[model samples]
Target: MKTEEVMSYYAHTKIEFNDMFTHRVPATINGMVHHSSTGCCSFVFPLSGQGYFTFDNVRYKLMPGMVLHINNTADIDMKPIGSEGCHYAVIYYDVEETVIAHDPFVISIDDYTTCQRAVEQMMKAFTTPGNISRVQTKAYFMQFISEMLVAHQRSKHVDREDAMSEALAFMRQYYQSGLTVTEVAERFNIERRRFAHLFERYTGINPSNYLIELRIQHAKELMRATDETIASIAEKVGYDDPFYFSRIFKKYTGKAPTAYRQCL
Candidate 1:
C-alpha cells in the first residue's frame, strides 16, 4: 500500500501508556502522523506486517520482529508498505532528565537480537487482554531499556579500550617523530604485514588511519590549550608542512586549524 493510505489506518488506532496516556487506533492501510511529546519517549513494536518510518527526514523500513524507539523530541511519520497493513504496539512513559542523562548512548535495536526479543515480548504483554498489570508493564519496559543500555555500554568499553591501548602506546613512543608502519611493527617485534592486520583488527581502522586520528586529536588539544601558531602545532604533531596538516585536519574534522582553534 502507499504510505498515505497506510497513515489513514494509523489515525484510527488506540495508543496507551501506563500512568501516561492510552490510545486505541483502528487498522487501516493509509497515512500516519505523530507529534513530539515532552513527557516521554515512545517505543513502537511491529508485531505483524511491514511499514516504514520517517525520522528527522530519514526513512527507515519497519519489518515484523522489529522494535523502534522514537525520542520525545523527534517528529515521526509512517505508513504501511504493501497489501498487508501494519500492526504496532506502542508505549509511552514520562522520562526524568536524570534518566535521560544517564543514557548517553543512543540505543539501536539493529545490533542486539536479544533486545529485539525483549521488545516483542513487551508488545505481546501489552496486546494480551488483561494479561499484564500496569506496574508489571512499566517494569518490563524499563528492564528492556536498561538491558539495551548495558549492552551498549559494554560494547563501547571494549571498543574504546582496544583503540586507546594501541593508539596511546604508539603515540607515547613516536608522537614527536612520526614512525612508519614498518618502524612501528619492528618496535613491537612483529612482522610489518601482521602488525598492520593486528592494528586494524583491534582499532577498527588501519594503522595509518589510526595514526592520523591520534595526531589530529592531539592537535585539537594543543590548539585549544596553547597559544601556539598553526605552523608550530603542525610541526609538533610530526607534520613538517602546515598546509599538509591543515588538509588532514579538515578532512577529519571538517574545519581548518584556525577555525577549529577559534571555536575553543
Candidate 2:
C-alpha cells in the first residue's frame, strides 16, 4: 500500500480497550501457556517475576519492567521462565482493521515503577469498573497508554517503588482526626481505589478497617485511663457520634465503652 493510501485508510481508526485482566499462569500444562486465541490486539506487562513469552514463533524473555504488544490475529503463549511462575497484566483492545498491530513487539520501560503503578490503577479500574468514576478510569487508561508509548519508543530501563512510607506516617499522625480513605489516598497522590488495594498489599488489612482499628484502639485507651465521657472519647478518637462509636467498639471488643470501662 502507498504511504498516502495507508495513512488515509487509518486516519479514522479507533482503538477500544476491552476485557482487560491480570493473570498468573503456572509453568505446567494447566497454565494454558501454549493456548491459541486469535483476533485480539493486546498489551502485556510483567508486573513481577520472569517469563518467556512466545508469539508468532519468536521467543522473548520478559522480566519485570518489560512490556509486550501483540497485534491482533496472532497466536501467543506465555509461561514462567523460572521455577517461580509468572504474574502479569493484559489488555485486549480493538483497533481499526487497517491499523491493527501486525507483529508482536517488546518494549523496555524506563520508569517501571511508575508504569506499574499506572497499570495497577488501570487493573483496579478494569476489574471493578464502577469502583471509580468513569472519568477517573478513563484518565487512568489514557495515562497508562501514554506512559507505555513513551517507553516503547525509547526502550530504556527505569523503575522505582511508588513510595507509600509517607502515607503510613501520615496515617499514624492523623488517624485520630477523622481520617478518610479517599482523603488519605488523595494526600498521597493516588486514586482512592488503587490506594485501598495497595494499602492492603502493604498492611494486610483493608484501609478502612485499619482506620477503624486505630480509632477503636485509641478509644479503649481513653476509656481505661481517663474520666472523659463516652461522647468526649468518641470525638477524640475521630468519631463524632458516641452511639456509633460505641457500636463499633462493641463489635470489635465485644463490650460497649461504658460496660468495658465499668468492668475494667
Candidate 3:
C-alpha cells in the first residue's frame, strides 16, 4: 500500500509452497540473513510484529494478517519494519506445481479468512513434527495456496471490468468495419494472447466470438430496418462473401437470411 515499488514484485512467480517453517525472528536482527539463492520462492506471514521486502528497488510493507511472495528469480531484500523484530512464518518452496492462478505478491487476511486459517494450520503442522501426516501436510499447503489464488483473482475482477467494457464498446463501434480480435487487442496495446485471456475472464466469451455475435446482430437489424439485399447487408456488416455470411448467420440463428426476413 502507498508504494509503486511493491507492485513490481508481483510480476513473477511459479508459486507452490515448499521448505516451510515458523521462525520468530528476534528484534536484535534486521531481516532474514538471506544469501543469494537460485530457483526458489519465499512466502512470509507475520504472526506478530511487522516487516517489508525491498523488491525491484521498492519497499513493500508487510504486517500480520497478510502474506507476501518473494520470487527467487531476482535479488530480494527483506527487513522488519520496527525494532521489536518480527515473529513470522515463512515457506521456502522451489518446485512450481502446474496450477492456474493469478499472482498477487501481497494478500490481506481480512477478506480471506480461509487463507488466514490455512496459514495458521500450516504453521502448526510444520512445527508439530510428530503430529504431521503426509497427506494432511500436503492438503494444508495446497489449500492455502488455492485460497490465495482465489483471493487474487477476486481482487482483480473489478479492475478487469473496465478494460472489458472498453473492449466491448470498441467491438460494437467497429464490428461493421472488418475488425478482428487481434486488432481490438492491439488498440488497447495488449498482446493478442493476453487480451483474449482477460477478455474471456471478464465476459465469459472469446473476443472473436463476441465480435461475430455483434456482426450477426447488426445484420439482423439491417434485415428488419430496411429492405437491404443479403449481399449488401453482408458487405455492410464486414463480410465480403454473401454465401459465407449466410452460412454463419444460419449457424448462429438456425435460419437463412430470406427465411429470417420472412419471419419478421
Candidate 3: RMSD over Cα atoms? 19.5
CA lDDT for candidate 2: 0.69
lDDT winner, 1 or 3: 3
Off by over 4 Å in 1: 1-28, 33-38, 98-132, 146-264
lDDT over C-alpha atoms for residue 197 of model 3: 97
| lDDT score, candidate 3 | 0.67
**Best-to-worst lDDT order:** 2, 3, 1
What TM-score, computed on C-alpha atoms, does each candidate reach?
Answer: 0.37, 0.49, 0.43
Task: Judge candidate 2 at residue 247 and give its lDDT.
Answer: 95
Give the residue spans of candidate 3 off by over 4 A: 1-17, 28-32, 35-38, 74-76, 96-104, 128-132, 152-264
lDDT of 2 by residue, 111-206 (tens): 678888888887777656464644565667667777765654343211113435556766666666566787666444456898888888887888
Q: After superposition, how far is residue 14 of candidate 2 from its true place, in Å?
A: 2.7
Ranking by TM-score: 2, 3, 1
Give the per-residue lDDT of model 1 (tens digit) for 1-264.
222332332334333345322222334544675645455566665655555667677766554323456656666566754435565555675543322322111232223556655656665566656745544665667666656555544443344345346445755546544545654554333457876787777767888887787789889989988999999888777687899999999999999999988888
